[model samples]
Target: MKIYFDYKVQDYLADESFRRWVLDGGFRNQDSAWSQWLLQNPDYAGEAMKARDIVLATQLTEEPFEEGYFDTIRRETMGAIQVKRRFVRPLWWQAAAAVVLVSGLLGWLVFYQAPSPETEVATQENVPAENVPFFQKNTSSAILPVALPDGSSVLLHPHSELSYHYGPAGTREVQLTGKAFFEVLKDPASPFLVYSGEMVTKVLGTSFTVTAYATDADFSVVVKTGKVAVSAPKEKNEATPGNADNQTTIHLVSNEQLFFNREKAHFKRREINQRDMLQYVPATHYAYAFEDTPVAEVFRQIGKAYGLDIDMEESLFSGCELTTNLTDEPLFEKLSIVCSAVGPGTSFVVEEGRIKVLSKGCNQ
Candidate 1:
C-alpha cells in the first residue's frame, strides 16, 4: 500500500515525538521509520527515496556528492540524528564523552549525517477505519478556531487534521497532525491528550504549540503556560493490565520545549526563551509593535509571510539592533520599514511567491 506525504510532514520527522513513535511498538521496524518519515515529509517523496537509496547503498565508493550539492540535498531530506548513550559509563564520564563526540561531529551528524540502511522509510496505505460516516467527518483542509469540549481554543493549521470523541470519559483524547496552537481551558479531572507524531502529550490545562507537520523535519511541543507530560505510546509490553508502553515521561513546564525525531529514535527536552515561543505562535491578527526588537527577526517574519529571500551580506544589521513599532502598518509597509533599516541603497522585491532582498550597497 502507498501513502503520500507533503513537505510539511517531512520536516517534522526529526521530532523526538516522532522518533518515539517509531521505536514504540506501533509499527514494525522498517514500516515505522518509513511511516514516521513520510508523515513528516509528504512533499519530499522523491528526495526521500533517493536518500534512502544512498543509505542502503552504504559503503559505495562513489565520492560523496559535491559538498554544496550534498549539503543542499541533506538540508531538504535530513532528519535529526541522536546517539544512544552508553549506560555503563558514569554520569560525569558519559557527559564528557558526549561532549567530545558531539563536538567532533557537530552539525554533520545532527543535521546532515547520511541515513543508515535500516532508516529508510517506506510509504504505506492507511488502514481504513470503519463506521465513520463521510458526511459527519470534517474535511482535512478546514481551518477553524475550534473550542474543545473542555473550553480550550485551538487554531488549527491549514490541511492538518484532528479527530475527537467526547463523552463522560475522564479525559479527552485527540489525534492531531500538522500544527496547532492550544490555549487550553483548565480541567484537572479531564486531562487533555494530544497524539502527534509518535508521542502523546498529556496536560491538565495550559497554552502550548504542537507542531507535527508531515513535511516538517522535526516534531516540537513548546509549552508557554502550565505543565505537560510527554511520553511514548502506551506500552504494549507492560505486564499489568493497566500498564502499556509506560516508558519514562518527561515533564515540561512553561518555557520548556520537547522534540521527537523518528530517525534519531529518541526524545530531547530543552529550555527555550520567549523568542523561540513567539516564532511558532501564529501571526497575530494585528501587527506587533516593537521597541528594540532585533532587525533579523523582522526580516525573518517578512520573509516567511511574503516568501522573500534574504541575502544579508553584513552582520551589521543582524545584531545592529533597532527600535520600532509595527502595530498599524501593512505587510509591505513593514517590509519597507526593514528595508529602510539597512540604509537607503538596499531594496526588496516580491516576485513569483518569493521576496528577494538585493543590495545596491551593503557588504559583509
Candidate 2:
C-alpha cells in the first residue's frame, strides 16, 4: 500500500483508486481504505472531500483523450530523477486520467528501476534473467511492487533500492539500501536473508519491513507476521556495555519491532500495536461477529482493533442490540450494517481523525 497520509489534494485527484472509489460508490468494499484513510488523517479530509467533489463533477462528464497526452506525461516523469513533493490542484485530471486508462498504461503512476538508466519490470510471463544481478529502485512517488524469482514479494518504498542473488543450498539473499516491506514465500529448505548495511535479517517464511538507510544513524525492523532474526557484527554487539547475554542476534515476532543505533551499537525492541499505521489494514486481521451484543460495545471493539477513536454517546445506543456475522465485510460497511440494525436516524461519520456515531435514538 502507498502512503496515504503524505497525499495532497492533487495526489488524490490523480489516483485512479481514489477516483474509482468516489465515482463508483465503492466505499463499502475494499475501497474502504479511503474511509479509513480519512478517519486516520483528518487534516487531509477537506482536501480529500474537495478532490472527491471534483471527481464526481468533472470525471462524470466523459472527456476525450487528447493526442500526445501519454508522451507528454512520460517525458515529464522520466526527466526528474528525484520527483519533488508537490501540493497543488489537478488542472485537467479527468481527461488525462481517462487517456491513461484507455491506453492501458494505468501503471504509469509507478515504474520499476534498474541499476542503469532504463526501467526493468518483471512479470509472470517475462521473468528477470537468472544468474544476472539487477537492481530495483523505487524512483517514483509511490511504492514499487517487486516480484522475486521465487514466490517471495516486496513492496519497495519510494527512493529505496534492492538487489538479490541466489546462493548455494537454494538460499535467497537480498541487499536493501533503504526501507522496504518483504513477504517471503514459506520454504523451509531455503532461508531468506536481507542484508541491511548495519545488520542482517533472516527469516524462513515471514512478512516484515526493514528500514536501514546508509547515511542514517538508526536502523529498525518491524515484523508484521511470522518471525524475524536480526543479527549484527560481533564487534557491534560486544561494544555495548552491560549486555551480559552477549547475544548478537535478536528475534522478533508479529507486532514487535527492533531498533538499533549504529553509533552506540545498542538494540532496543518495542511492541508496536497502537500507533503503527499502514495504508492498508486487512479486515480479516480480526474476526468480528456478534451474538445479540450491544451496539456500543461492538463499536468499541472495532475502534480498538482499527486504532480508531470512535466518539459516541454510549447511553444513546444502550438499548440497541445486534446479532450478525461480520467476518468478511470492510470496516465502513460493518458500521453501516450495525447502524441499520440499531434503527433509523443513526449513522457514523469520519471527523477529525476519528469516527463519530450520530444517533437520534436507539431502536424501540
Candidate 3:
C-alpha cells in the first residue's frame, strides 16, 4: 500500500494487481490490497477511477504491456525519433497499434481532481453572485435533461419541476416538486442536496431517483449508485446524540431504497431488488436495451438516452458490435461492458463533462 502512495492514474493502470481488481468487475474491491489502501487514503479515488477505465478498455487482451510501454507511447505522441528498441516483454508490438488514440485518452481523462480544501465550487460561475438560480419545468411529453450549476445533471420526468441555486455557502441545492433522476458529479467540498417537501436527500456524488409528488402522501428515493443520506421529519424525530442539529438522517448505499411519508413525516428504509429499480424511475427513460447492435449505434443510443455527449472515433468500431440489456448498472459500468465486448485495446474516459472512447479499432 505504501508503494502506491505516489501512484498516478497512469501508474495504477500499468499495475497488474490494480488491473485485476478492475477486471473483476465488482464495485466492492474489499479483498484487494489497493482497496484497503484506498480506505486509508480516500483522496485517490478519482485517480483510481480514471485508471480503471484504461484497464477495462484494453482489458480483453491477455498480453502484458511492455515495461514502461506507455512512456514510449508518450514519447511517440510527442514525435520522438524511432530509436532501436530492446524487448523487455512480449506483445508490446501488438499494443503499440493503440498509441494513435492513447494520447488523446490520456490528456482528456484528467477529470475532476479534488479541489484544495480552501477553495470550493462557487456553482455561480459567469453569473450573478446572488446564488445563480435555475428553475426548469419539464412540460414536454418526454424526459427533460437539465444541467445544474454545480456540474451535476438531472433527468427530470415529464411535468416535474426543478429549482436550484448555489449560494455563497457553496452548497449545491435543489428543490423538487415531482419525480426526477439525478446524476451528481463527485464533489467532496460542496455537498449536493435535494429537498422534496419534508424529505431531504443529500449526497457528495452519486446517481439516484427521487419520486416526491406533492399530491402523494409518500415520497421515495432510490439510489442507483454510490451512497446518499436522507433526512426527514419523524413523529418522534428527535436529534441523534451528539448531533448539533435536530435531524434524523438515514444513510443508504447501493441497493438500498427509502420511502418517506410526508403526511406523517415517517420514513422506512429497505434493501431493494435490482430488477425492480426501473419501477421507481420513469420507465421510458431508464428502460433501454440493445440487441445485435453495432458498437457505433450503441454509443449513439446511450448518449441520446442519457443526454450525454459520447465522442467516439466511429471508424474504429466499424466491425464491432454488441448485444446487452442496459439496466440497473450505473453509467460508467455500461461503458465498461461495451469496451470489453469490442475485444482489446479499447477504453473510455470522462472529460469536460462528456465521454470519449479510445480504442485501437477492430480487425477486419
Candidate 4:
C-alpha cells in the first residue's frame, strides 16, 4: 500500500481499493487505509483528488461492454503498467487519462460534447426508443472479419473489441479497442466515424488501420488509401460555436501515419514506413528496373511500389533521366541509388519519415 503513494494517477484509478474508496464516496470506514495515506502524504493530495474525479467520471456501472472485453482491458492495462514501471516515470494525470482513454472509459467522461442548436432540435424531434448498442468481441485466435450494415468491413484482431450503433439518420459510429483494419464504403449522405479512446477518425471512403491496444503506450492510425481525418476529443470547457466542428483535426492522405502518445497527449505525423506500406499491397510484384526512364516516372513507380509519398520539384527533374536495375534493395538503398543516378549533387533526405529530394536543375 505504501507503494501506492508513489503511484501515478492511472495506477490509482486502476487499483481496486482506490476504486472502492471513490465509489463508496470516501466514507471513513470504507477505505481508511487509503484516506490515512492521503493525509500522511499531503504532497500527493492534488493527484489523488484528480484521480478520484476521473474514477468517478469514468466508472463503469452496468457492464455495458461484454465480459470478454472487460477481461481483455484489465489484462492489457495491467500489462502496460508493468511494462511502463521500468525506464520511465510519467505525469500522474496524463497517464491516468491515457489508461482510461485506451480502455474506452473516456467516453463516459469526455467526448460528450453538447450539440449545437440545430443538432439539439433535430435530436429532440427524432428521439427514438432506447437503442441497445451492439458490442462485438474477437476472443478467438484468428482474425475476425465483420461486415457492417453500411457495407464497410472491419478485420478485428484477436482479443480486440468493437461497439457500434447506427443512428436514426443512417450515420455509422463505431468504437474500437485494440487493432483493426477498416475498408469503409463511401456514402456521401452518411459518413463513417470510429472512436478509439480520446481520438476520432472520420472517413467517407478509405482503407486504414488503427492500432489502439490498451496496453500499448501509444495509439496509431495509418492510412493506406483515400483520405481520412483524425482529431482529438474536445475539452468540455473549450466547446464553443463554429470551432466545435473542427477541434484539433488533422487530415491524412495515402501512406500517412499519425501516432498519439498517451502519456504526453502529443501527436506525431509522418509517412508510413515503406515495409509497412508493402503489407497493404502484398500481391503486387514490382520489377525495379528503369532504362533511360524519365526521373519523374521513376519516382512515381517507386512511390507506387512502396506506397510512400515522395515529394520533389517535378519541373527541376523534367528532362532528367535515370538508367538503373534496382532489385531487392531496402527503401533507402533504392532511393540512394536513384538519387546518384539522377545527377551529381542530387540527394534525398528523410524528414519526419518523408523523403525530400534535394537537387539542382538537370544541366540544360
Candidate 5:
C-alpha cells in the first residue's frame, strides 16, 4: 500500500494497487488515490507510463489452456503421484491426493509456456540472438577508450557509464548516463543512435560529444564532425514501423550544438566558439587579416575557423570587398567590423547560431 516516489518501472508493475489502477482504468476510489499521487509527483509520471505500457502489452486476455486441458493434466498428475507412491491409500485420501496434485500442476501451467517451432524461429529471426549486452563504466582517473563491436570508439569520461549491444545489424544503439565523446565508424546503412534520458542523438558516421547525466538539469549534444540528428523519443503510439520521419528532430552539422532543457522540454541551438575549437583544430598558419578580400571568402574562412555557418544574400555581396586587419577578437567583434565595412545600411543578425547578413548592396 505504501509506494515510494523513487520506484522504477518494474516496481510499479509489481505493485498490486498500481496494477488495479491500470487494469481498471482508474475509475474506483483506490485508482483515483494513486492517480492523484502521480499528479503530485510529476517526476514519477514517465516511469509509470512506461510500466503501464508493459502491463498492457503483456496482459492475458483469456485462459492459456484449451478446453479439457486441465482434466488431462489432472489425470496425468494423479497417475504420476500414484506410481511414485506405489501404495494403496484410503479412497478418500486417494481422491484428496489427486486434487492436491492437480492444483500444483495448474500453477506450473499458468506460469510457463512452451513455444511452438514457428514461434521459436520467428523469435530467432526478429530478436538479436547473437548480440549480448555490453556495459562499460569509466571510474578511472583519466578518460577511458571503449572499443565497440562496430569498430567505432567512445571516450568515456570519469563517472560515466555506456551500454550497448553488439551484433551484425544495420543499426547500432547505445545508452549513456554521463558525458562521453564518440567517434563512430562510417556505416551509411547502419546509423548509430545514442539514448540519453529524454533526448536521442543519431548519426551515420560522425564524431560528437554528449553530456547527459541523471543528476544534471540540462542535456547537450555537440557535433564535432559529420551530421547528427537530435530529438525527443517518440511516444509509443507515434512510432510507426519503417517510418523515419521525426517532426521534432533538429539536424546539426559540424560545429553546431543542441542544448535541451529537461524541465521545460525546450531545445536551443548554438554555434561552438572558436576557443572551444582550439582543442580540436590546432592553430594553423592561416591569417585572420583581410586586405580587399572577397566577402564570400572572408565569411568562408571565419566559418571554417569557428565551425559556423554564415548565411548571406550572395547576390547582394557579389562584388563587395572587405578591408580590415582583424585580430584575435571574439567572433562577434570580427563580424561587427565586417558588417560596418560592407556598407552604411549593412547589418547582421545572429539566430540559432548562424549569422545572417542583411545589406542594401554595396553598389547602391
Candidate 6:
C-alpha cells in the first residue's frame, strides 16, 4: 500500500499555525506512529513542509487555492487506485497523471521515514559538477576566500566552504560551518544569502561576520558596516538556530552585534565598541563584558580566546561572580591576575597549554 498522510494533514503540517497544533496535538507520550515521529522533531517538520510545498506547487492550477484542493490531494495521497493511467490516457491526461506519480514518491520518502532532527542542516548535497563553484584556501590568514565570477568576495574562516552558480540567473549562496566575513559587492538586483544550517543572513551591499560552528553553543552575527537582515529558514525553528522558541529577527545597524543561542532559542542585540568588533579577528586584542558575569563563564570565554584547555571544578564557581577587565592580557597571565583578585590561596596549574584553576577562596 502507498504510504502517506492525507492532503489535509499535509497542509496542516505545513501551516505555521499548525506548529502549535502539533505541539499541543496530544501526540506526546503516545506510541502512535505519526505522533512518535513529529512530536519534538523540527527536522521532521521541515521535511514534511518541503514535501507539502512540492505537492502544492504542482497541483495548483490557478491564482487562488481551491476550497477542495486538499480533498483532491487526499485522494491522490492514498494508493494509486485513483491515479489516472498515463500510458492509455490522452497526452494532457498522461501529463496530469505524471504529477501524481512524482508527488506520491515524494510523499512516501518524507512521510514514511523522515530524517532525524539535526543541528547541522545541509541544504544541497551532491551538487552537479557544473554547478559547483571553485574554492581556494588562504592558509596565511586561515581564511578560505571563494572567488565569485562577479568580483564579489566571501572570506571563509578555517574549515568553511562556499558554493555558487555562475552566469545569468546566478545567485551567490555560501554554506558556512565555522565562521566567515563577507564583503559583498553592491548588487541590488541579485541579493546574496549565506546559509549556515537554518540561519540565513541576507545582504544587498554590506560587510558582516557570521559564526555558526557545530561545536559552538551559539551563533553570532556582527555587522561592521552597512545593513544586514538575518533570518531563519521557514522550515527551521522560528527562533535563531540555537535558541528555543524566541522568534525574533535581529536587524544589525552598522557597528551592532547580535548573538543567537541555539540551545535557548533566543538572541540579544548589543551596541559593541569598535574594539569588540576586532576581537573575532585572529591575533587581535580580545574584549569581554565583565558586568556581573559568572566566574565560570568568564573562564570559559578566556579559554576560547586563548586557544587553551581550561578545567575547573563545578563547585568552585557555582556562586562566584566576577567584575574585572580581560582587555589585553595573554591567556595564562590573565587567568593569574583574575585569580589574584579572588584571594591569595587561589592558585592554578598550567600544563601542556591547559590551565586548571585550583583551590577555593584565596587566603589574603
Candidates' C-alpha lDDT: 0.53, 0.65, 0.67, 0.65, 0.66, 0.55
Rate residue 193 of model 3 by lDDT.
Answer: 90
TM-score winner: 3
- TM-score attained by model 3: 0.48
Give per-model TM-scores: 0.37, 0.42, 0.48, 0.40, 0.39, 0.37
Tens digit of per-residue lDDT, candidate 4, span 270-290 = 997768865432212323557
Poorest stretch of ten by lDDT in candidate 3: 80-89
Q: Name the candidate, 2 or 5, with the larger TM-score value.
A: 2
lDDT of 1 by residue, 1-364 (tens): 2433432334334444443443453334546656566556656656555544444344336867544666534532331111122222344444444443333222112112223423222100111121121111124453344434333546566667676544246566778877777766556787888887777888876667888877766688888756788876433444245555455578887678888775554678999876776766544333444556776666776545423355455455665555554432234334544555444454454323234555454211
Error of 2 at 246 (Å): 8.7
Q: Which structure is stronger by TM-score: 4 or 5? A: 4
Q: lDDT tens digits, residues 127-152, model 6? A: 22245454433334444433343435
Model 3 agreement with the true structure over 1-364: per-residue lDDT tens digits? 4567688999888787788788886437565676777877788777988898777677454788756668745743342121112112236433542442232222222222223422223321233355545787877776665555455667778779989877467878899999998877667788989998878899987788999878988889998766799997545555465544656689887668898887677779898885787666433243346777899998887776566568999988876766565543345545655664564577776544357888788532
Candidate 2 lDDT by residue in tens digits, 65-99: 65566764574344322111111113443343333
Tell me the TM-score of model 1. 0.37
Error of 6 at 319 (Å): 65
Query: Candidate 5 residues 33-112, lDDT tens each?
Result: 78788877888889988988888888877858655567745854564454335224335444444443333222222212
> What lDDT score is found at residue 292 in candidate 3?
74
**Deviation from native of the Cα of residue 257 in model 4, angstroms:** 0.7
Per-structure clash totals for the candidates: 50, 0, 1, 0, 0, 11
lDDT at position 172, candidate 5: 90
